[model samples]
Target: MVNAPSGISGEASLEDRIARKARELGFVACGIASAAEDPVRAERLEQWLGEGHHGSMEWMETRLAHRRSPQGLWAAARSVIALGMSYAPAHDPFALEEVGDHARISVYAQGKDYHDVVKKRLKALARWLVAEQPGAQVKVFVDTAPVMEKPLGEAAGIGWQGKHTNLVSREHGSWLFLGAIYTTLDLAPAEPHRDSCGSCRACLDVCPTDAFPAPYRLDARRCISYLTIEHKGPVPEDLRAGLGNRIYGCDDCLAVCPWNKFASRAAAMQDFLPRPELVAPRLAELLALDDAGFRALFSGSPIKRIGRDRFVRNCLYAAGNSGDAALVGPCEALADDPDPVVADAARWALERLTSAP
Candidate 1:
């Protein structure tokens, strides 16, 4: 166990002590939030879901009750400790835009799976909390459960939910990986971060598919990140061109946020540094990934969960948009893919590439 700093042992409150310990444990940001229900947050979620903005993510609907509040998930959880780990990229997220032969990957998915990385640290923090105060029960979550992590993150002062419907920190911008610890102990809540996006339309304007219906409201159906990674079939034909070179996830909105100017690239952990091959992978190469090949390539990556077919489907979409005739051979090979969805995408890419002058 790492000991506290020399003079900080005399701190007045336990929350302060715990927060200091959280910093020591590698959390870039840490704050407290109550377990009580937040009516506004709940109503907003209900509205988002009611509007079908969540697209095909049915789990949000099924877990509505438990997700509305921390107490709803665990009655004994008196306070929630929100933590953020920075994965801010050290390089430009838009570097591959003109490089048509290559594919663009979201910064978040270009390295080790964040679910595993964040959860491990969350568990370690939870264990430390338990050991510090014997019998203290804690539950840690990192996007796995029904928990509404974004709103809770905002309430905990980690950052406010921006117009892109993603958390944006004044310090770290849109580069945080959030996690939470629900504990039986009642801790003083931090002041909630107010919406700082005032008059800023950068994120909204940068979205190629116009995913945002309005400021702070996203229609996931049109989001490239949702389409490439979550939508399970051939993408909507109308939106295919907008996907461009983004083969896995989209970063346009996040990359354009003015707040990102404040983010420090050096603060990013080594675990999230983009792998050399994944940094700017050739679209043709990605279009050739077989199931086993895809599995090996993305072995510890979040992209693997979407499977080879979906991945290739995305690469094909990029190929069609690439305007690079060299990808035609690879696109032709997958026109009869076993997965009907991948086959459909291949046929579509052939039409685009062949039709172009």
Candidate 2:
């Protein structure tokens, strides 16, 4: 454990102590940024929202001011500590797509819910800070918050936000899960990192739905991650065909990044290991899961948040794209699901199956 400098007591400098503690807590990288104006990002976010690119994630619009600048959220906040953990998978995520009958869950969703894992660690770090300096105030945030974590992570030097709009680190590649700790104490800010993705259009070219309108700008409406996780009702018919076998979030952008070749495998956190059934689940079997079965199977996983209806809806699409007539039965069975969205997707899948020669 790294200790504060002699004679400093609670007034010890934050740089060395915090970095050492973050490493001990298993964070791959930690960086600090003073809460300040981000004019460029503010303009970009406003433009993205004006174009209605966020789809049904209305919350993005609700916290526009705070999302663009952290100081807007907490006036007392002096420093934003951005932390990242590696969630790299042992196998290539793209490989699962080749198995026509199986559903492909994004690498991030294959393990335990990252919200829980990252939050626990963030809270621990926050508590440590407060313990070291009595009366210190702090707040922690994961993806649930309205904060623009990607830009903050970038500003903090943890990584650069890639063209796909997710933060990418050279050390961890694009496989990092980000969390933030906002503290009232002033901390030495780290130098922001420069973008290393020069001339690399791999992520842009690989997106099936063409979500990127330009480098670093994403139209989430067309993003599979938004379709499967955020968009509530029927997925736009035009995008369904491009969804391929993905039943949760899409990883084409992240998977195709050349930086990922250097990504480390899953950390020692066993909670991140793929659940036996989730690794390459049969689309037919997944579509057959009832509400109770779905809840039971995804009890500890991030997929549970989508619930059975949306999950089955996603499975229905994958089933349709499987090109295997064997999945027809499950699709047909789900055509009358109690949830209108699920039933509607099932109908669409059935049509695709029947229409196929």
lDDT (0 to 1) per candidate = 0.90, 0.86
Query: What TM-score quantifies how close candidate 1 is to the native fold?
Result: 0.96
Residue 98 deviation, candidate 1, in Å?
1.4
Worst 10-residue lDDT window for candidate 2 reads 1-10
- lDDT tens readout by residue for model 2, 1-357: 122253366554666778778888888888888777689889989999999998889989988878878888888888899999888888878887777799899988988999999899999999999998888899999999877788888888888988888999887889888899999887778777788899888999999999999999999999999999988899989999999999999888998888887777855356678787888999888988998999999998888988899989999998888888998898989878889999999899889999999
TM-score of each: 0.96, 0.95
Best-matching candidate per lDDT: 1
lDDT of 1 by residue, 1-357 (tens): 112233456654667677777877777888889999999999999999999999999999998999889999999999999888899998899988989999999999999999998898899889988998898999999998988888998998889999898988999999999999999997788889899999989999999998998998999999999999899977999999999999889989999999999999877777888899999998878887899999999999999999998999999999999888999999999999989999999999999999999
* Clash totals, every prediction: 0, 0
Error of 2 at 86 (Å): 0.6
Tally clashing residue pairs in candidate 1: 0
